[model samples]
Target: MDTTYTGDVTPGGAPDVRELPHLRITKLAVDPQMSNNCYLLTCRSTGESVLVDAADDAAALLRLCDAALEGVVTTHQHWDHHRGLAEVVAATGATTYAGAPDADAISEQTGIAVDVRLQHGDRIVVGDQSLEVLAIAGHTPGSVALLYADPDGHAHLFTGDSLFPGGVGNTFGDEQAFATLVHEVETKVFDRLPDDTWFYPGHGNDGRLGDERPHLAEWRERGW
Candidate 1:
């Protein structure tokens, strides 16, 4: 298993792949304007794959899937996060999944209904592997992070726009929203996961939980 991947990607460029014992994680940057990140998780044993956040560039996303795509999990209802959702689902016939609170909005925005309304603690199967859904509501009512716990290694978290290297996602000055997001992230992520857990964000480079753990108090104090 290779752990050298940095999860750095550029729009219209090739994806950076990380191969694990039972799964392969491919991160790609799409949508030139938003620079959104898209992750594809392929189960090594079964060859089935699931995509997290079909951000944009349908053709590129399709090419990456290469006929092995099984489902698409939208992290939130944000326009940038699902710009290519409709096209990709149409082309691949992949099942759609999203947080229950954002399902209607996502469907309304993309014209594709969500096949599964995921809630906190919901489990999504990708071949022989599975991902746990963690609802971290703040940036959006249904923003969620996917947790992949590897038996042979540390955990992996895919935090859409909720948690990043420096702080949590933007809340548009809504103090309540920021507080809720911080609380959810603190309890569900920082508190539950180990320090070595690697997290892939929606936009930029990835980070480990241990690297970000010390700043929890600072993040809360600044309230971003």
Candidate 2:
């Protein structure tokens, strides 16, 4: 990967294709391309935006902004999913937000100091847009998924590495903390989110709630 990388689609089955009103979601593929999914959410009314997972090229992320950069929300502290935190904030003066428990790690990367530290069930506001930060740990101690609504009231899940399109993220990387990822996904991430909300994984394509609903049983079998 170079300093200024371009975005693309993740591999595997066809990627999630959503057509939301007043909001556009672009799957900006980045390094370690398989499971790193980055997103851009732009408000139609204000031309302001919030970016999810600035783990890619800061320049590329900015180019994709196309609107004023309001903030960067990290789903977890993984380097591949968060390497651009400093560049993004420096470029836009945007605040840094993450699972409140991740404040230390986020602060270390951001250096502007963390403006907001959120826990599960907390929501951060950017313009009229409010993104509900759900603590979905396991893949990491502080992985979070931002659940927000589209204009028509449809919900979108920007799930980190906890869940994915066809399969779920591998928990072996966590060593002793593997259970955290599984429990967080089955209980925290999937428990509250409607079975109908669209699930976008950190490193893969999107899977609608309806489409991947059955996989929940399999995910639970692993004992979260």
Candidate 3:
């Protein structure tokens, strides 16, 4: 295809469009402050795309997306994650999608109501691609993860803040929240997804499920 961009997006400025030849995914990040990751997955055949987590720097996000943008998906309602939500949506008029409970919460901050209220098992359409919604609540009341399966049987998970490389995300010292997050990661993620499943977290670098699979018990026992 003679694509111009390659490799993973960086966490400094507006990333030069990253094209994943393996899965035909186009992603970019804008880390002006919080280093929140914003991704754009485009259907190579259709030119349509979906933006995930419009965190910070709306202008950079818009530049990466522009007319190809189809919709914006919110993984949770955390303030840092949706800092640029209002500006991005207002500028693009892209439909907003979020978990039912979190949809309203995000709307409160962005002031732009969610257009689609997602639930577990729901399918989010992006051109010819479909991303399955996994409701992994715990990091927040309605935090969810998105799973995209490639043609070759591998999978990519967009785990907002639920599942990270070393742990299951911060519970803010709440034991119950910690337990819930742990339980969901075990059942909904580690148990179901394959070892090769690559996950893109909210804040840092990408991680493979296999690299993190062995630490399930440790994470549970530590309870952080």
Q: What lDDT does each candidate get?
A: 0.94, 0.69, 0.83
For candidate 2, give the lDDT: 0.69
Give me candidate 2's TM-score against the actual structure. 0.81
Best by TM-score: 1
Candidate 2 local lDDT, 1-224, one digit each (tens): 12222233753322232335566566676664434667877765776778888886777777777548788888777677778778888878887787767768867765646677778788877566777887866666777888876657657788877777665666665544656665666676566667677777776546777676677667556643
Candidate 1: worst 10 consecutive residues by lDDT? 1-10
Best by lDDT: 1
Off by over 4 Å in 2: 1-19, 32-35, 109-112, 151-153, 173-176, 222-224
Q: How does residue 83 of candidate 1 score in lDDT?
A: 89
Ranking by TM-score: 1, 3, 2
TM per candidate comes to: 0.98, 0.81, 0.92
Q: Write the per-residue lDDT of candidate 3 for residues 1-224, one digit (tens) a residue.
A: 32565435666554645445433555556664666778888877777888889988888788778686889999999998888888988888888899997888899887889999999999888888889999998999889899998775578899999987798889999999999999999999999989999888887777999999988999989997
What is candidate 1's CA lDDT for residue 117?
98
